[model samples]
Target: MSEFLIYEQQGPVVTLTMNQPEQRNPLTGNTAVAEFLAAIDRIDADNSVRCVILTANGPSFSAGGDLREMKRQSTPAVSEMDIRQEYRRGIQRLPLALFNLEVPVIAAVNGHAIGAGLDLACMCDLRIASDKAKFAESFVKVGIIPGDGGAWLLPRIIGLSRASELAFTGDTIDAQQALAWNLVSRVVPHAELMDAARELAGRITANAAHALRLTKRLIREGMHSRLDTVLELSSVFQAVSHKTPDHMEAVNAFLEKRKPQFGS
Candidate 1:
């Protein structure tokens, strides 16, 4: 039902492929954000989904916002406040929905990820880059800023200094440089990108489903919460995880020296 997303599932892994190859899958000034939020909401509610791979169909992962649309809306009729409100009700929702997603999300960067495009990859829990992938935090080049939370997300992935360099210079970095900066966990052949993503997803989905969600929440909370707060959250999550059917199955499977069959 999504206008721009090609939602496909294989076992416990869901793949959200941005299907705008010609337009480079621009997130804003189009249906991408709405489709993404809807899909993410469904994934959050579906316990069967343990992992998600976010990718695109075209040469560019995403070219960010639509420049022609921006130019059209730059008229005097559209005030500064109007643009601010537009963003608040538009692209800003992407970070919120993606960040709070219950299942782990992996970005399979196939090609160029520019400006907000790069930030979208950062929102994922993990990034697997194609050898031909290129990235740039290039808002400055367009006389704009990263209105999609790149300032926060980029710094957490790479160091503040490195993120600053990218934002300030607005320069593009290839997949190898991204790997060196720890921007992406792995860089594989472009032809093998999806295979690598699936292989990683397989390892993640092999674990107990409920536990994986709980562990991801604990990790996210630990990023911003105090140690004591994280400890409290961990205890609560641990207690809940201990009660899951998957947990019991895992324990029994280990005891019996067999593989676990998780219903969820």
Candidate 2:
């Protein structure tokens, strides 16, 4: 329904493609941010959608903030506090929404993911980059910090030392380097990016949808939770999963030596 994002659904998988290729799918201004949020809402409401793939249509995954929009907002009329409020209310929402969304998300980085673009990729539960893709924590190059929570997101994904290097340098790294740093889980030929992403998504979608969401929630919680806290949460989630009809189907299928028909 959004002009800036193309949302497509195929069975249990949803693909959110950033459609502003001419602009390199910049995550700035109102349209991009609103569209992304709306897409997340749709995904959350749909129980059938087991997985999401975040990708872009053009050569660049995203160029980050729209420079023209930034320039427009940087005027005598808008104070520093106003800009801070805009970031808090605007682009920052994408990371928060995606991070909290229960569904599993995989970022298919097809090209250059720069500045907040790289941060966007970090928001996903998994990342798959193309061989031609490039990544950069480039906010510093533009004389601004990562206003979209990259500072918090990047360190968690790649660790403090490596994240510090990227943040300080604002230099671009190739797909191989990103994989080496564990910024992305896998890298494939540019032509095979979508296929690889869908293949991974298929693997995930084969499981029970409710269980997948609960499992994803547990993983996210585990990141910041104590071992005991995670254990407790895991037990609760496991109990919930056990109650789902899909869980029964899985057990029966295993005993019968057949593939489970989840949500049946």
Candidate 3:
């Protein structure tokens, strides 16, 4: 595992914190992508993790690519093919891993999220930003494009019009603006961000775990599939869900007027 990430679990929830505070938690020039992939694989294998909270340990959520690393790679010795291979083997892998994760994920944005950082937040199913948080699709300002799948992720979250504006201008938007643009669901005081995230996770985990996973899958499928395709997938998943112990427990508890005690 990389020193850049801190992975911890509590009951049904897993928290992944980016810990490279002194360097602003950059995604490149480090082992962050590999660690994230490994941590995600571990979480997928663990049956109990129903929810995830993604946040950073310091002021900036992530500085996107490491500028120092970018400068180092800009030398004439680094060919176009080398850079292409670098991305395919590096930060580009994170979008597919995080987005395809089965459990629900919440990003608690504590501060600035720029370029790939903003794209990272978009990878989560939900986002809760601190009142102090700022976001920007800022690759243009750095004289580069978002080579980390920001082009696709940003437009999907905030729509093509808003995404286009941000990409073209590379201007920063604060928490309130982010909420207005639907980039983030809610904005809370910086001090209350983690509390808010935990409370939301609690609400999510109170239901049948199997049902939650099925529901998340349905939502993700709906994002890219046709209505008929999603409905077909939903039917099959629902059938599987109906046979689980937790589903039976949920139904019986409702009829008995008591709380459900679901199994893992």
Candidate number with the higher TM-score (1 or 2):
1
Clashes of each: 0, 0, 0
Report the lDDT tens digits of candidate 2 across residue range 1-264.
Answer: 577899999999999999999989999864999988999999999999999999999899999999988897888888999998888899989889998999999999999999989999999999999999999999889898888989998999999999999999999999999999999999999999999999999999999999889889988888889999999999988898889899999999999999999871
Q: Tell me the TM-score of model 1.
A: 0.98
Looking at candidate 2, the ten consecutive residues that score lowest on lDDT are 27-36
- Candidate 2 clashes between residue pairs 3 or more apart in a chain or in different chains: none
Over 119-184, each residue of candidate 1 has an lDDT whose tens digit, in order, gives 999999999999999999999999999999999999999999999999999999999999999999
Q: Per-residue lDDT for 1-264 in model 3, tens only? A: 469999999999999999999988899998899999999999888889999999998899987999988997899999989999999999889998887788899999999998889999999999999999999999999999989988988988899999999999999999999999999999999999999999999999898777887888888888889999999998899899888899888899999999999777
Locate the minimum summed-lDDT window of 10 residues in model 1: 65-74
Error of 3 at 14 (Å): 0.7
lDDT of 1 at 124: 95
Candidate 2 local lDDT, residue 152 = 90
The pairs that clash in candidate 1 are none
